[model samples]
Target: MNQLIRTVTLLWSLALTTGDDTVTCLYSQECVLPCKSDYREIIHWQKLERQTTVNVHSFYSGTDQLKYQNEAYRGRTSMFSDQVSKGNMSLILKEVRTQDRGRYKCYTAISSANKEAFVSVKVKAPIKSVDIKMTDDGITCKTSDVYPKPKISWTINGTPKIISPKDPQEDSRGLFSLTSTLPVQPVQDSLTYTCSISSEDSTQTYIASLTEEKTEIDLGQDITIPCPGSQGETGNFTLTFGSSTVLSYNSETPQPDRIQWNGIEVKVTSKGNIILHKLDSERHAGTYTCEKLTTQSRQLIQTSVQIRTASTVGIIIAVTVSIVVAITVAVIAYVIKKRRSKTSENNGQEGSGGTGHNGTPLDDRLQSEQLVEKRSGTWTD
Candidate 1:
């Protein structure tokens, strides 16, 4: 009966020890496996593999003993030597790997009293950034620093399309990078395209249009190009004219010299709009693209600028010249009209004495009247 009671007591004591713990660690990052013990005479952290137990880390004999550590975790496993005296036996693991996901045991002993704890670890690397840009072939979507692989999908004008991307490329840290392209035509009307990147942990999507927004600008005038759909965002921006990059900077980076682009002064607003001090028909005319780059995705807004043949100053000058010419012509016409009027008045006065009502001079008219009066017996006429 005493043997049975002692066996029951031992089983109950073992069951009351530290319960199992689960910890999720990020890939290529430092992680801590928690364990607590009042006594720190001897400590052992072991990994329970498929068929055998592997030494992850050990703390005993006044220092850490890593001579028997597993080859895969030789330089990655460590324990807090100073904190162990206060009942903290946590293990510090650096540069965690996917292969490190498993069960771990933390065992510590002091004389006859001992304690142990169990922990389960999981390592993951989530999706970071997805960059979408225009290419000669089509629109390409790319992302890097992901784990457990990722899938890229496309939606064209609200319709789902299944386009397989190239196989994900693995880096030295076992992370993934992928690229996918979708063929698109130059569209007069806007065509909406949405690309989504999905990993084991989460999903991220980016939307862009294939159509270009049009803006009319006069030559030699300042103009501000709006970055559509980016009103309140603060992110890395790149402004490109046609295929040449005009300006590129992050929100925190210093702005480049404005007069660097062939004497064109460029200014960026807090909202990511760009202002050109002077618009050049030859160089500044064409497509202007604004891209907002973030950790999740890349957004694009394009504007096609058409420069007028005449500048504002040139138009004003032309109008002024036209008004001046009109005034000069009016003045010349008025002078010629006045001179003709005077000449006609003089001619009327000079010709008045040359002919009378009966085609006779004044003296001849009087003699004729006297002859008529003698014939008609009326001399007073």
Candidate 2:
């Protein structure tokens, strides 16, 4: 039909005007605007907008000439000169901004023919902040002001959570504020709920937690405190007590021990929980702080740990030691008594004065008679 041909032509024109290629990137991150084909001799990048075309970058005579670059792109855009050969002419943009969204022109002046590529850049607005909490109703997630509205959803224990999202409100600055709540039902096992917010380019999340202000464990018992993750984004968790970092994950430490992440009482898990085995009163008991950090955000939670020493174990050990000592004393006394009895029996065989070595009379009647006869001469008649 003529109408169909006209619609197709209009669509083709719109595509050519908008661009064939598009690059979506997050705010405050690097973006690579790609342009395939070799333009080694000369290349020019320009931001094309309505009624204005601003110079972004230019390469000529084997050197980058930035004097014509727009001030908005100063020090934020660069092309990979080393990779310019073999039909590669990609420009790297650092810290992309929403205002930078527009069409870009990559023109290369070749001797045979001029080549060009048009690209459309789409900048994603990062979720400024994410706050999640547990309430009587259920888990609630709130977002800070975001532009163009972010994609918000919930996942419970890694499964998609069916939640009715509240209507987002628009602020005066045209930014949007969103809230998503997931009603919790009675569940037997502990459940983990994560609120994920995403833009076209990046995703960030916050997970719910059910931790007390403090945890108490008996000394020599194992304890594992959960790290519920960060509000915005987190790549790692760090556990610190006093000045010492007991354990760290995803930290840039060069030591092999740090690489393996082993501690005396503290160990970091992939789920972000810090596990302590055989809790030590001296080392493992105190205020332990857990920090989750991403490249852009950080979350911290400090929990007091009360280590209780099992005095009953000590008492049992003491009682067992006392019993052993008493038995040893009784055995020594019995051995001494037996030795004395044997010495007395040996002296009885060699009894000279009737009383043996142990002060017992060896021959009672004979000894008494002998003593009286011996004393008769000394006594007066």
Give the best candidate by TM-score.
Answer: 1
Estimate the lDDT of model 2: 0.69
Give TM per candidate.
Answer: 0.67, 0.44
Report every candidate's CA lDDT: 0.78, 0.69
Q: Write the residue-wise lDDT of candidate 1 on 58-159 in tens digits.
A: 999879998898899978978788888888999999999978889999998876567879999977787766766678988888878877788777877678
Question: Tens digits of per-residue lDDT for model 2 on 1-381?
Answer: 999998876654441122469888776689999887644678889999899999999977767889989998999988887767666778899987767888899887666446678998877666766766557777777776665566677766677877666777877545577877788756534455667766434454433333224777777788876665533343666777766777666644321232222335455554446677776554567777676655444455656788767675688689999999999999999999999999998877667655545555655665787779778864333
Count of backbone clashes for each model? 0, 2
What clash pairs does model 1 have?
A: none
As a whole number from 0 to 100, the lDDT of residue 169 in candidate 1 is 94
User: In candidate 2, which residue pairs get closer than 3 Å at backbone N, Cα or C atoms, i.e. clash?
Assistant: 37-87, 38-87
| CA displacement after TM-score superposition, residue 131 of candidate 1 (Å) | 2.5
